[model samples]
Target: MGTDMGKKESLLFCLDRFLDPWFGYQLPYQDAIVDLLQVVIVSDNTLSVKEAALQLICDYAWPPFPVLEENFERVEAELRPDVSYAMHMDKEIETDS
Candidate 1:
Protein backbone atom coordinates (compact mmCIF):
# COMPACT_ATOMS: atom_id res chain seq x y z
CA MET A 1 0.00 0.00 0.00
CA GLY A 2 3.00 2.29 -0.11
CA THR A 3 3.58 2.49 -3.81
CA ASP A 4 3.30 6.16 -4.77
CA MET A 5 -0.44 5.82 -5.13
CA GLY A 6 -2.49 8.81 -6.25
CA LYS A 7 -5.04 10.36 -3.90
CA LYS A 8 -7.94 8.22 -5.03
CA GLU A 9 -5.84 5.10 -4.90
CA SER A 10 -4.62 5.89 -1.46
CA LEU A 11 -8.12 6.54 -0.23
CA LEU A 12 -9.40 3.27 -1.68
CA PHE A 13 -6.46 1.38 -0.27
CA CYS A 14 -6.96 2.89 3.12
CA LEU A 15 -10.64 2.07 2.96
CA ASP A 16 -9.78 -1.50 2.05
CA ARG A 17 -7.60 -1.66 5.09
CA PHE A 18 -10.52 -0.61 7.18
CA LEU A 19 -13.24 -2.66 5.49
CA ASP A 20 -11.21 -5.84 5.64
CA PRO A 21 -10.87 -6.05 9.38
CA TRP A 22 -14.02 -4.05 9.99
CA PHE A 23 -16.01 -7.16 9.10
CA GLY A 24 -14.44 -8.94 12.05
CA TYR A 25 -15.79 -6.15 14.19
CA GLN A 26 -19.21 -7.54 13.19
CA LEU A 27 -20.09 -4.48 11.19
CA PRO A 28 -22.39 -5.83 8.55
CA TYR A 29 -22.96 -3.24 5.82
CA GLN A 30 -26.67 -2.50 6.01
CA ASP A 31 -26.90 -3.27 9.69
CA ALA A 32 -23.88 -1.16 10.49
CA ILE A 33 -23.44 2.00 8.39
CA VAL A 34 -27.04 2.71 7.55
CA ASP A 35 -27.99 1.93 11.11
CA LEU A 36 -25.41 4.34 12.46
CA LEU A 37 -26.58 7.08 10.16
CA GLN A 38 -30.15 6.58 11.29
CA VAL A 39 -29.26 6.88 14.95
CA VAL A 40 -26.97 9.82 14.49
CA ILE A 41 -29.67 11.59 12.55
CA VAL A 42 -32.50 11.19 15.07
CA SER A 43 -31.11 11.19 18.60
CA ASP A 44 -30.78 14.52 20.36
CA ASN A 45 -27.72 13.50 22.33
CA THR A 46 -25.48 12.51 19.42
CA LEU A 47 -22.83 14.56 17.74
CA SER A 48 -23.85 17.66 15.82
CA VAL A 49 -23.50 17.52 12.07
CA LYS A 50 -20.21 19.35 12.42
CA GLU A 51 -19.19 17.11 15.25
CA ALA A 52 -20.11 13.95 13.35
CA ALA A 53 -18.22 15.21 10.36
CA LEU A 54 -15.22 15.83 12.52
CA GLN A 55 -15.57 12.39 14.02
CA LEU A 56 -15.82 10.84 10.59
CA ILE A 57 -12.63 12.56 9.61
CA CYS A 58 -10.91 11.66 12.82
CA ASP A 59 -12.23 8.15 13.18
CA TYR A 60 -13.19 6.87 9.74
CA ALA A 61 -11.95 9.25 7.08
CA TRP A 62 -8.91 8.41 4.97
CA PRO A 63 -5.93 10.53 3.98
CA PRO A 64 -5.19 12.03 0.53
CA PHE A 65 -8.70 13.13 1.27
CA PRO A 66 -10.54 14.60 -1.69
CA VAL A 67 -13.23 16.22 0.39
CA LEU A 68 -12.77 19.45 2.28
CA GLU A 69 -13.19 19.01 6.02
CA GLU A 70 -15.77 21.76 6.35
CA ASN A 71 -17.90 20.31 3.60
CA PHE A 72 -18.06 17.15 5.64
CA GLU A 73 -18.63 19.35 8.64
CA ARG A 74 -21.70 20.76 6.96
CA VAL A 75 -23.05 17.34 5.99
CA GLU A 76 -22.52 15.70 9.36
CA ALA A 77 -23.97 18.77 11.02
CA GLU A 78 -27.40 17.40 10.13
CA LEU A 79 -26.83 13.84 11.29
CA ARG A 80 -29.37 12.35 13.71
CA PRO A 81 -27.89 10.22 16.42
CA ASP A 82 -31.13 8.40 17.10
CA VAL A 83 -31.56 7.22 13.56
CA SER A 84 -27.98 6.15 13.24
CA TYR A 85 -27.73 4.68 16.69
CA ALA A 86 -30.65 2.30 16.50
CA MET A 87 -30.01 -1.43 16.38
CA HIS A 88 -33.17 -1.71 14.36
CA MET A 89 -35.11 0.93 12.37
CA ASP A 90 -38.62 -0.31 13.13
CA LYS A 91 -39.02 2.63 15.51
CA GLU A 92 -37.46 5.51 13.60
CA ILE A 93 -39.60 8.32 12.24
CA GLU A 94 -38.41 10.63 9.54
CA THR A 95 -38.84 14.00 11.21
CA ASP A 96 -38.55 15.91 7.99
CA SER A 97 -39.85 18.93 9.77
Candidate 2:
Protein backbone atom coordinates (compact mmCIF):
# COMPACT_ATOMS: atom_id res chain seq x y z
CA MET A 1 0.00 0.00 0.00
CA GLY A 2 2.99 2.27 0.09
CA THR A 3 2.52 3.24 -3.52
CA ASP A 4 -1.11 4.05 -2.94
CA MET A 5 -0.21 6.21 0.00
CA GLY A 6 2.39 8.00 -2.06
CA LYS A 7 -0.04 8.58 -4.90
CA LYS A 8 -2.68 9.79 -2.49
CA GLU A 9 -0.22 12.15 -0.87
CA SER A 10 0.86 13.49 -4.24
CA LEU A 11 -2.72 14.11 -5.32
CA LEU A 12 -3.49 15.87 -2.05
CA PHE A 13 -0.44 18.07 -2.45
CA CYS A 14 -1.52 19.07 -5.95
CA LEU A 15 -5.01 19.85 -4.69
CA ASP A 16 -3.67 21.92 -1.85
CA ARG A 17 -1.59 23.91 -4.29
CA PHE A 18 -4.64 24.48 -6.42
CA LEU A 19 -6.58 25.56 -3.34
CA ASP A 20 -4.38 28.60 -2.97
CA PRO A 21 -5.88 31.99 -3.64
CA TRP A 22 -5.16 33.42 -7.06
CA PHE A 23 -5.54 37.06 -8.06
CA GLY A 24 -6.30 38.20 -11.56
CA TYR A 25 -4.88 35.07 -13.09
CA GLN A 26 -6.14 33.66 -16.35
CA LEU A 27 -6.54 29.92 -16.67
CA PRO A 28 -5.40 28.88 -20.09
CA TYR A 29 -5.46 25.28 -18.99
CA GLN A 30 -8.71 25.14 -17.14
CA ASP A 31 -9.78 22.01 -18.95
CA ALA A 32 -6.61 20.23 -18.02
CA ILE A 33 -7.06 21.24 -14.39
CA VAL A 34 -10.63 19.95 -14.38
CA ASP A 35 -9.51 16.71 -15.98
CA LEU A 36 -6.85 16.20 -13.33
CA LEU A 37 -9.35 16.82 -10.57
CA GLN A 38 -11.81 14.42 -12.16
CA VAL A 39 -9.17 11.72 -12.32
CA VAL A 40 -8.37 12.24 -8.66
CA ILE A 41 -12.04 12.12 -7.73
CA VAL A 42 -12.48 8.75 -9.39
CA SER A 43 -9.19 7.22 -8.36
CA ASP A 44 -8.73 4.65 -5.59
CA ASN A 45 -7.36 7.33 -3.31
CA THR A 46 -8.70 8.28 0.10
CA LEU A 47 -11.79 10.35 0.75
CA SER A 48 -9.71 13.35 1.75
CA VAL A 49 -8.07 13.62 -1.65
CA LYS A 50 -11.32 13.22 -3.50
CA GLU A 51 -13.03 15.71 -1.23
CA ALA A 52 -10.27 18.21 -1.85
CA ALA A 53 -10.68 17.77 -5.58
CA LEU A 54 -14.42 18.30 -5.26
CA GLN A 55 -13.83 21.37 -3.17
CA LEU A 56 -11.54 22.77 -5.83
CA ILE A 57 -14.15 22.10 -8.48
CA CYS A 58 -16.87 23.87 -6.52
CA ASP A 59 -14.73 26.75 -5.45
CA TYR A 60 -12.52 27.44 -8.43
CA ALA A 61 -13.85 25.75 -11.56
CA TRP A 62 -17.62 25.50 -11.14
CA PRO A 63 -19.00 29.02 -11.27
CA PRO A 64 -17.75 29.93 -14.72
CA PHE A 65 -18.41 26.64 -16.50
CA PRO A 66 -21.09 25.03 -14.28
CA VAL A 67 -20.82 21.74 -16.18
CA LEU A 68 -18.60 20.29 -13.46
CA GLU A 69 -21.58 20.41 -11.13
CA GLU A 70 -23.02 17.44 -12.97
CA ASN A 71 -20.43 15.13 -11.45
CA PHE A 72 -20.80 16.21 -7.84
CA GLU A 73 -22.73 13.11 -7.00
CA ARG A 74 -20.12 10.87 -8.55
CA VAL A 75 -17.31 12.65 -6.72
CA GLU A 76 -19.27 12.47 -3.47
CA ALA A 77 -19.78 8.78 -3.96
CA GLU A 78 -16.07 8.31 -3.37
CA LEU A 79 -16.51 9.47 0.19
CA ARG A 80 -18.58 6.46 0.98
CA PRO A 81 -18.20 3.81 -1.64
CA ASP A 82 -19.97 1.11 0.40
CA VAL A 83 -22.34 3.12 2.60
CA SER A 84 -25.13 5.55 1.97
CA TYR A 85 -24.36 9.26 1.94
CA ALA A 86 -26.60 9.91 4.90
CA MET A 87 -24.72 7.30 6.91
CA HIS A 88 -21.40 9.06 6.43
CA MET A 89 -19.88 11.59 8.81
CA ASP A 90 -19.88 15.32 8.08
CA LYS A 91 -16.11 15.66 8.40
CA GLU A 92 -13.48 14.51 5.92
CA ILE A 93 -12.37 10.96 6.62
CA GLU A 94 -8.84 9.76 5.89
CA THR A 95 -8.80 6.10 5.02
CA ASP A 96 -5.44 5.88 3.30
CA SER A 97 -3.47 5.08 6.40
Candidate 3:
Protein backbone atom coordinates (compact mmCIF):
# COMPACT_ATOMS: atom_id res chain seq x y z
CA MET A 1 0.00 0.00 0.00
CA GLY A 2 2.86 2.35 0.71
CA THR A 3 4.24 1.80 -2.75
CA ASP A 4 0.79 2.38 -4.23
CA MET A 5 0.42 5.59 -2.27
CA GLY A 6 3.81 6.75 -3.44
CA LYS A 7 2.93 6.03 -7.02
CA LYS A 8 -0.32 7.93 -6.66
CA GLU A 9 1.45 10.90 -5.12
CA SER A 10 4.06 10.86 -7.85
CA LEU A 11 1.42 10.86 -10.58
CA LEU A 12 -0.48 13.68 -8.90
CA PHE A 13 2.69 15.70 -8.58
CA CYS A 14 3.52 15.20 -12.23
CA LEU A 15 0.02 16.20 -13.27
CA ASP A 16 -0.03 19.29 -11.10
CA ARG A 17 3.43 20.49 -12.09
CA PHE A 18 3.56 19.49 -15.74
CA LEU A 19 0.28 18.35 -17.28
CA ASP A 20 -2.03 20.70 -15.41
CA PRO A 21 0.03 23.74 -16.28
CA TRP A 22 0.44 22.73 -19.91
CA PHE A 23 -3.05 21.48 -20.77
CA GLY A 24 -5.19 22.82 -17.96
CA TYR A 25 -5.57 26.41 -19.15
CA GLN A 26 -6.68 25.63 -22.68
CA LEU A 27 -10.19 24.57 -23.69
CA PRO A 28 -8.96 22.36 -26.52
CA TYR A 29 -6.74 20.32 -24.20
CA GLN A 30 -9.34 19.85 -21.48
CA ASP A 31 -10.32 16.44 -22.83
CA ALA A 32 -6.71 15.37 -22.83
CA ILE A 33 -6.36 16.40 -19.23
CA VAL A 34 -9.48 14.52 -18.34
CA ASP A 35 -8.18 11.48 -20.16
CA LEU A 36 -4.90 11.67 -18.32
CA LEU A 37 -6.69 11.95 -15.02
CA GLN A 38 -8.83 8.95 -15.88
CA VAL A 39 -5.69 7.00 -16.60
CA VAL A 40 -4.32 7.93 -13.19
CA ILE A 41 -7.51 7.00 -11.41
CA VAL A 42 -7.80 3.65 -13.14
CA SER A 43 -4.14 2.83 -12.69
CA ASP A 44 -4.64 2.27 -8.97
CA ASN A 45 -7.18 0.03 -7.31
CA THR A 46 -7.01 1.92 -4.01
CA LEU A 47 -10.22 3.83 -3.31
CA SER A 48 -8.45 6.61 -1.44
CA VAL A 49 -6.05 7.19 -4.32
CA LYS A 50 -8.90 7.26 -6.81
CA GLU A 51 -10.84 9.69 -4.60
CA ALA A 52 -7.77 11.91 -4.29
CA ALA A 53 -7.38 12.04 -8.05
CA LEU A 54 -11.06 12.91 -8.43
CA GLN A 55 -10.75 15.60 -5.79
CA LEU A 56 -7.74 17.05 -7.58
CA ILE A 57 -9.72 17.28 -10.79
CA CYS A 58 -12.65 18.88 -8.98
CA ASP A 59 -10.47 21.38 -7.15
CA TYR A 60 -8.04 22.31 -9.91
CA ALA A 61 -8.47 20.92 -13.38
CA TRP A 62 -12.20 21.48 -13.89
CA PRO A 63 -12.13 25.20 -13.17
CA PRO A 64 -10.81 26.39 -16.53
CA PHE A 65 -12.87 24.00 -18.60
CA PRO A 66 -15.74 25.26 -20.75
CA VAL A 67 -18.77 23.43 -19.36
CA LEU A 68 -18.52 23.48 -15.62
CA GLU A 69 -20.81 20.85 -14.08
CA GLU A 70 -21.12 18.71 -17.19
CA ASN A 71 -17.41 18.18 -17.55
CA PHE A 72 -17.12 17.28 -13.90
CA GLU A 73 -19.87 14.71 -14.14
CA ARG A 74 -18.62 13.35 -17.42
CA VAL A 75 -15.04 12.98 -16.23
CA GLU A 76 -16.09 11.53 -12.89
CA ALA A 77 -18.35 8.95 -14.50
CA GLU A 78 -15.69 7.97 -16.96
CA LEU A 79 -12.98 7.62 -14.33
CA ARG A 80 -14.84 6.00 -11.45
CA PRO A 81 -15.56 2.40 -12.26
CA ASP A 82 -17.82 1.73 -9.26
CA VAL A 83 -19.73 4.99 -9.32
CA SER A 84 -23.05 3.41 -10.17
CA TYR A 85 -22.65 0.68 -7.58
CA ALA A 86 -21.61 3.17 -4.94
CA MET A 87 -24.58 5.40 -5.70
CA HIS A 88 -26.94 2.48 -5.57
CA MET A 89 -25.56 1.31 -2.21
CA ASP A 90 -25.83 4.85 -0.83
CA LYS A 91 -29.43 5.08 -1.90
CA GLU A 92 -30.19 1.66 -0.44
CA ILE A 93 -28.61 2.61 2.88
CA GLU A 94 -30.44 5.94 2.84
CA THR A 95 -33.81 4.30 2.36
CA ASP A 96 -33.08 1.69 5.04
CA SER A 97 -32.17 4.30 7.60
TM-score of each: 0.25, 0.49, 0.39
Error of 1 at 50 (Å): 1.7
Lowest summed lDDT across 10 adjacent residues in model 2 is found at 82-91
TM-score winner between 1 and 3, please give it. Answer: 3
- State which candidate has the highest TM-score: 2
lDDT tens digits, residues 1-97, model 2? 2347667657656655555556544567767777676666655667776676666665555333222334445545445442233223222243433
Candidate 2 stretches with Cα past 4 Å from truth are 1-22, 63-97
What is candidate 1's lDDT per residue for 9-30, written digit by digit as tens? 3444444445444555444562
Candidate 3 stretches with Cα past 4 Å from truth are 1-5, 19-30, 39-44, 63-97
Residue ranges of candidate 1 with Cα displaced over 4 Å: 1-47, 69-97
Give me candidate 1's TM-score against the actual structure.
Answer: 0.25
Query: Which candidate, 2 or 3, has the higher lDDT?
Result: 2
lDDT of 3 by residue, 34-94 (tens): 6555555545356666776665565454333333223335444554444333324445656
**Top candidate, metric lDDT:** 2
Q: What is the lDDT of candidate 1?
A: 0.36
**Candidate 3 root-mean-square deviation in Å:** 10.3
